[model samples]
Target: MASKNLENFLALMAKVKGMDPTSDASLDIMQDYVTPDMEFVQPPSFPHGGVHGGRDGWRHMAKTLNENWQLHISPDHMWDIPEEDVVVLYVNMEWTAQKTGRTVHYPTMELLRFKDGRIARAEIFPQDTHAVLETLNAHD
Candidate 1:
């Protein structure tokens, strides 16, 4: 069950990166994999910088992020918490700015909580946020 849940998340990210966010497939993936009340905690310095809730929030976040960069995520590690319905994932990601054509590769740690087999919450902690900001600023 844990592995399946993780795979769903992986697929979700893949769809987000590989297809247009507003496309039917992308929207369907989001609806099927994530709970309707799901929320994402994002760093203020990041491009999609806020607490985004629900499918609409997810769509808005995708829009904001796509406006800035195209993201490619590579999962490095994943572990399910023993006493809780949560998974911790470490990922290496590359974000290429759409406008400037500049890219930044960075690592991020995310805590995901699941409810009834659907993702309910996610909190992201990016390593070297300053470096990401610096790279984005340089291109701007």
Candidate 2:
């Protein structure tokens, strides 16, 4: 059951990434996979850099990302900590700065806490914020 839940979460993420962020399909997937009170978090070096709540928060995050960069996210490794009901994922993230056309690639680790098969909280930690920032700033 845990494995199936993890697969569903990963599939939802992939489907969302492939579709237009504002599309009905994407919104539906977000609603299905994320809890209504879910908290989405990003590290300080991330563009938005804070805690965003619920599906609307995801929409805001998508808007910020679309406005600032083009991104590709790939899941690398995933494991579940049943005790905490958390799924830890290593993700490969690549993005191009829309403003400067500069590109950066980095590994991001994410902790996703789940409740009733939906993500209750998601947190992202990039391996090297300085490198990411430097690459984004290169063409400036």
Candidate 3:
């Protein structure tokens, strides 16, 4: 059986997968599954890279990423570490540059920590950060 934390994580991902990143609805969805003190980490190579603290910071990062690229993420696998209250998710992601129409396809491994059944920390590790940066910097 899947842990409650993993189920909540999957539910959250499903809610946000196709939603507008900057929309109020998206924020509401985030609030449902994430703690107010949530921390999100992205690769420095990304335009919106860095460690984002709190829900507001996460909102900023999501909005910035959406503005720069159209992202499609499909979860490939997920494992729950019940002892540590963490869920590890592997996803296949495709980012299409809005300006240049270039696309970068990569896999990402994410570590999510839960607090009171809500996501409190998330760290993303992309398989090919260089390719992602190249696609983002590409011109038509």
Candidate 4:
């Protein structure tokens, strides 16, 4: 059986999927799955600022990403490391640029921190970043 935390996490993940990547997903359900003062981060050399703090920051980042490129993430696995207040999700990302018609797929890992049943922080690492961007930019 899945732990209650895991179950809740899955439910939250579902909400994220229903969210339109082109819009404000974080704002739509922030109260349910995100803590106040949450942080969002992408690893070094990320196109966006390395880190953005709070809900507003997340929204801005998401909007920017959507405006620049199309993204799809397929979840493969998730682990609740409650002892560390972290959840790690394995996924594959497929990106297609609306402008160029180029596409690429890559494995990715999303590391998130949860607090009080909400997300506090997140980080995404995609293995084939060059391929992803090339495809996305091609359409542009």
Candidate 5:
């Protein structure tokens, strides 16, 4: 059986898949699963990189990325650490540049922390930042 937190996390991911990242509907979905003070951390080298605070901040990050790339994250494995209120996911991320139609595939590890059944923080670590950057800059 999955922990309640992990279950909620999975539910949240399901709701957001293929949804418009900048839409009000997406924000509405996030409200149900995320803490008001939810923090999202991404690599500073990436275009959408930064520490985003709160649900609104999360929306901003999502919107920023959505503007440039179509992203698909497929979870390869997941571990629920109930004692720590954490769920760790190993995922394959595919990013397609909207402008160039170039695609990059890479692995990433994500840590999601829960508070009162809602996600309070999410941190992403990508395996090949350079490859992703190259894809982002591709001309053809």
Candidate 6:
């Protein structure tokens, strides 16, 4: 059985992916997974170019990324670091432009944390940032 945190994390991830193209994102779908003072950060490789501090901070970054490109993050694998309240996941992330049909595909590591059954924090470290960059520039 999945732990409460694990369940929340999975639900949150799914909800987030489902909304990227249409809505700001159903990120608050798993608000229960977050603390009143949650902090989420990312590495520079992400489309939004990384950010720091709080749930709203992450939301702003996500919105910024939506402006930069359409994000499609599909999971390839996941490893649970139970003791640390972390889930290290391998994912295939693609960025595509609707107008140009230009696309970038690559792999990345996502370090996710859960607190009180909510996704309290997360970060992404891309494995092939070059591929993503190349994709972004291909049509230009």
TM-score, per-candidate, Cα-based = 0.81, 0.83, 0.90, 0.83, 0.89, 0.78
- Model 6 lDDT on a 0 to 1 scale: 0.69
Give candidate 6 regions above 4 Å deviation.
Answer: 14-17, 45-47, 98-100, 138-140
- Model 3 per-residue lDDT at 91: 88
* Residue pairs with clashing backbones, model 3: none
Question: Candidate 5 has what TM-score?
Answer: 0.89
- Over 14-119, each residue of candidate 4 has an lDDT whose tens digit, in order, gives 7777555446654576547777687888654545547878877777777777765677778898887877877889987777766686877878998988776677
Clashes of each: 0, 0, 0, 4, 0, 2
lDDT of 2 by residue, 1-140 (tens): 46655866877877787665545567777788888999988776677668988888877876776677777778889997766778999988887777778888989999999887788998989888776666557542
The local distance difference test score of model 3 is 0.86
| Runs with alpha carbons beyond 4 Å of true place in candidate 3 | 20-24
Task: Write down the worst ten-residue block by lDDT for model 1.
Answer: 131-140
What tens-digit string does per-residue lDDT give for candidate 5 at 1-140? 89999999888889988875446787788788889999999999888899999887888888888877877778889999989999999999898887778888988999999998898999999999877777767563
The superposed Cα distance between candidate 3 and the true structure at residue 121, in angstroms, equals 0.4
Predicted structure 5: lDDT: 0.86
Give the C-alpha miss distance for residue 73 in model 2, angstroms. 0.5
Q: Once model 1 is optimally superposed onto the true structure by TM-score, how far is the C-alpha of residue 22 displaced, in angstroms?
A: 9.0
Question: How well does candidate 5 match the true structure, expressed as C-alpha RMSD?
Answer: 1.8
lDDT of 1 by residue, 1-140 (tens): 45656667767777677565545567777788889999988898887888999988978887787777777777789997635768899989787777667788989999999887679998989887776666556532
Give the 10-residue window scoring lowest on summed lDDT in candidate 2. Answer: 131-140
Kindly report which residue stretches of model 1 are placed more than 4 angstroms away from their true locations once superposed. 1-4, 7-24, 138-140
How far out, in Å, is residue 55 in model 3?
0.8
